[model samples]
Target chain A: MAEKPKVGCARPTGGLVGQPEARQEQQTSQPTKEVRTMIQVGKPAPDFAAPAYHKGEFTSVKLSDHLGKWVVLCFYPGDFTFV
Target chain B: MSVDSVFVHKMWNDHELSKMVKGGVPFPMLSDGGGKVGTAYGVYDEGAGVENRGRFIIDPDGVIQAFEVLTPPVGRHVSETLRQIQAYQLVRKSKGTEATPSGWKPGKMTLKPGPELVGRVWEVWKTSMEAD
Candidate 1:
């Protein structure tokens, strides 16, 4: 009979610790950062305010203007990515 | 998790952004054109145009409750947004009677909170994650 693995022990199957691709895949799956200091949970989000296209012209936007509202600040590269 | 407004880094070109309005997708898109907002948000990739995919969910009271940023190459998980939104609502509304376990979802059991509930929380967290 095969020995049973203990609780919190390694999985009996794939994605083993020695697999370098699996490890590399894990890192690659996350957001890449040029700098080492990656922002994380509980950290204060950086603030931003820029020109906004309201109806026609570019109106300015300040982060503090909406002090009491939920802001989902998202930044994307250019105008048209498949993103 | 849940937010009222989304301020995308960079300001947009009026004509270009207006073009997107012709499409079906909803939600305002800001174009951090000058990189000012991108710099402030830490989403600026100087050599790159515009900004990196940085997302933050700031609450009504100006507290950043949750944030997510992705590199240009990776796709952001919208499902996680839904999960976090539901979890935040559940925890905030429940008055500390329960705590959201890992990989929590809507209609699932949240562990009873407090020091007495740590073991139970871990169990729930494990089960939910396994199911995830």
Candidate 2:
């Protein structure tokens, strides 16, 4: 069997790691940025690469890798919270 | 499909989420830890600190064919999603010249878009409906 990929999370508050608690708290309290530009239909989707949980393991997923195939990109708020 | 991290996803799958989601989540549950994906897709709610329920279906060419964002209280219907995928697949196979009607299934009649079809769709479609 292949080795499972490591899973890392964003540290609460701000940047990746080791930010001050105040900063973290500020980040946690800050509202999500209101994105002015919305992706439109009949246009290319924004590309992204991120770790995904799949079949009991961590793996990487990229939007570009699926260029020739159909993709269903679902964005839910959170897990296990009436999702 | 959440802003939760992979770690949270793993934990949830190991515990509560798996039970609530019968047969498991068939596709990958991507982690948008920084909400980059959510922001790009225009579903992230900054004030609420959570993403709305957003679904996008991309065609083989990477163009978004259909997308919808719903409030957190309402859950999406999986069967309708499947039907949409089928409909879009049919249209793609037809080279974008055909379109699926409402509640279209694979075997259902499809419409050809043109000036000739204008204002006469019901007459043409009624024949197929009667056949059904």
Candidate 3:
């Protein structure tokens, strides 16, 4: 018998070495209605650091580090799902 | 970027999108497993449990110059994005002196920023556009 995966909290636990279910649990929360405030343009982009899979490895990337260069922050849905 | 973890990103790259891109994607695909970035960007689609395909262009000064948030099932145009970035770069280099016109590209005419060009831009740009 196999154990069920644990749910992840609000932050990443670091690195790429984690169970699929636990890792995915973070983004799979059920949607609810709330007043949504839009992040306005012409303002400083919100900073973030996350484990990014680039080239052939998973490295931590931060938005502040690219301060002196152009940055394109794109967000898509989960991988392996139909777009 | 995908909402999956780095581990899942690796798996998807190694097994899926990598095959199409040959050596693999050239840019960093950040993982937003916790949806914080998406929430901050206001692109998180809570009902669908996924980010709503957001693309933001940030300047070197870290200010967002342009952005687009599209629903899933609509693919983005890489060429248009490239053109936009180039336009932004051109404008930044001009230091508020020039503005990129429609369908503007490198070597294309840029309108000078002044009160004179406001109402009379068509007279100057019409010939250049007809030549193209």
Candidate 4:
């Protein structure tokens, strides 16, 4: 019977730990920053009023206006994107 | 929400979304110009001048019960969002006494949250329960 490998005993030495090239890769991989706000579950959602296009008419929408109903705010990158 | 202007939103709804969904989305398509609202929601990408794909489920009390942010390459599902809203409504109707299990749907069995349920959830719930 083969001995089982010990957990947390295998550490890569020359592999992407502290290399300058690895650091550059980390910086380049930084995508959008999504941690700017303190939004959290069970907390009050940030309120905002903005211009909206609804049902062939231009109008304005306020977050506070939908207080007594369930609101689903769907945000996307752009309008025409296929995603 | 996005940094796109309201004109663009209207054009897109008229030209594209109308063909996809009937009546071109029954809800408001807000134009978060300059990513202001997106910034407040933390979904704004300053470099791209657009908001990332995000969704927030706000209850009647204005509390954010759930949220999700995804990269632009991924699309969100309306069915999943609807399911979550129903689940949240059930939980709220029960006043937090009932908790929905994983893959729970409307009219499915829910778990009663209490000290007695601790460590014995496995006995009460099974993965097979997810199938209708």
Candidate 5:
């Protein structure tokens, strides 16, 4: 079967080029007891995280890191911004 | 929306999202409650906890348009999203003649560039960067 790069975790995320899920498995667990609002068009954007692109490369970027600053957590589900 | 959220990927501490932040992505990408953003955009599958691909055009007024959620495993295009922005911008500048065609780069062919195209927009998209 052709392996496609999975955008999120907990699945095969079969793309051969993706950062192996085994890597992130070492730290942190799932968040619970919170709605973790995914879509907020008008309200203040929620705080959440994922290893993100920083300085022209992927690094550990957390929302708490930007506490007191402005940030736009524009989330996508797949490769290269959707398409 | 004074504050906006745009998530192109999700890999907390993984190489991708980390690269984005380190690479000067200029934004933070929150988790979607196991794809909650997709769910909010009506694109997440309750069983899979992933998302469908779609363009959610939210006006600064906080109204949603073109909020079309996509199907399983498909992807979206940045250029297409840019086209939406282009379309919004054109409409704001006045009724122009540019529809922001496919692969429409900025400053490219916009409605053949001619007169008599009053109130006839070709590439007018909306975005938050617009002036009030």
Candidate 6:
């Protein structure tokens, strides 16, 4: 007869094993009253302003500034990564 | 949007992107450091400290008309984005009277949606028309 396997001692410990305390603390610290809104079609886009590199010059870009014309916000992982 | 800084964007454009496209990209390469904009757009990955690939097409009224998000491994096509933009523009210009079928391009046939077209789409539109 094969030896009995260790019961409950061979539990897989791949994910969420050591990080639960930090995660729970983070959740408890934040206010539950705040609502998170998801980005949806047919809804007004959340406006933003940030530094940008355009045509060999450094400038700022604001979403609301391009109100009169159509805007395409193309996002990628990073500058050097394949897009 | 991404977590890369403006300096990195400039270097990448100067060294790499310029060879791919003339004068690099025509639009601004925003440096969304700390993922503020990405968080707002729901593309920020908290564990990775970066944003996933995403695109948003905002109409003239500042409302988001369409959006696409993908993982880092897959690449996006500029031609497809342009085609979608053109299709959206045509529909907007027509004031909801016209609708472009799948894979519709400019100069292709468009369907006039109405009560008459409710069930007769097969009669007026064909898959072959998408090539036109």
4 against 5, candidate with superior lDDT: 4
lDDT of 4 by residue, A1-83 (tens): 11222223332111111213334434654422332455889998877666666787666677877899999988899978888
Model 4 RMSD, rounded to 1 decimal: 16.8
Residue B79 alpha-carbon offset, candidate 5, angstroms: 1.7
For model 3, the stretches where C-alpha displacement exceeds 4 angstroms are: A1-38, B127-132
- Model 5 misplaced regions, further than 4 Å: A1-83, B1-14, B18-24, B34-37, B95-105, B108-132
Candidate 3 lDDT (Cα, 0 to 1): 0.72
Evaluate candidate 5 and give its CAPRI docking class based on DockQ.
incorrect
For model 2 chain B, the run of ten residues with the poorest summed lDDT: B123-132
Better of 1 and 3 by DockQ: 3
lDDT of each: 0.52, 0.73, 0.72, 0.76, 0.41, 0.74
Which digits, one per residue and each the tens of the lDDT, describe model 5 over residues B1-132? 101112233333244545645543344333333443343344555565455555555443333424445564565566666566656566445555445444455565545445655554434533422322
Interface RMSD score of each model: 13.5, 3.4, 3.4, 11.6, 9.5, 8.8
B1-132: candidate 4 lDDT, tens digit per residue: 666766788789899888998888787777776565676678888788888889999999999999999989988888999999999999999999999999999878899989999999999999899776
Give the alpha carbon lDDT tens digit for every residue of A1-83 in model 1: 11222323321121112223334534774422322243455555444443443443324455556776556666666544565
Recovered fraction of real interface contacts per model: 0.41, 0.73, 0.76, 0.76, 0.14, 0.72
Across B13-76, the per-residue lDDT of candidate 6 in tens digits comes to 8999899999897787777765656766777777888888889999999999999989889998
Per-residue lDDT of A1-83 in model 6, one digit per residue for the tens?
Answer: 11222224222111111223324545664521121254899998877666677788766677777887999987788878865
**lDDT tens digits by residue: candidate 3, B66-105:** 9998888887887878889999998999897989887687
Candidate 4 chain B: worst-modelled 10 consecutive residues by lDDT: B31-40
Question: How close is chain B to the truth by TM-score, in each candidate?
Answer: 0.70, 0.85, 0.91, 0.93, 0.52, 0.93
Fnat measured on candidate 2 = 0.73
C-alpha lDDT of residue B42 in model 6: 76
In the range B1-132, model 2's lDDT, one tens digit per residue, is 777877778788878767868756657777776665676678878788788999999988889989989999899997778888898898888898999876567777889999999999888676446333
Stretches of model 1 off by over 4 angstroms after superposition: A1-40, A54-58, B1-25, B95-97, B122-132
Supply candidate 3's per-residue lDDT for B43: 87
| Ranking of candidates on lDDT, top first | 4, 6, 2, 3, 1, 5
Model 6, stretches more than 4 Å misplaced? Answer: A1-36, B130-132
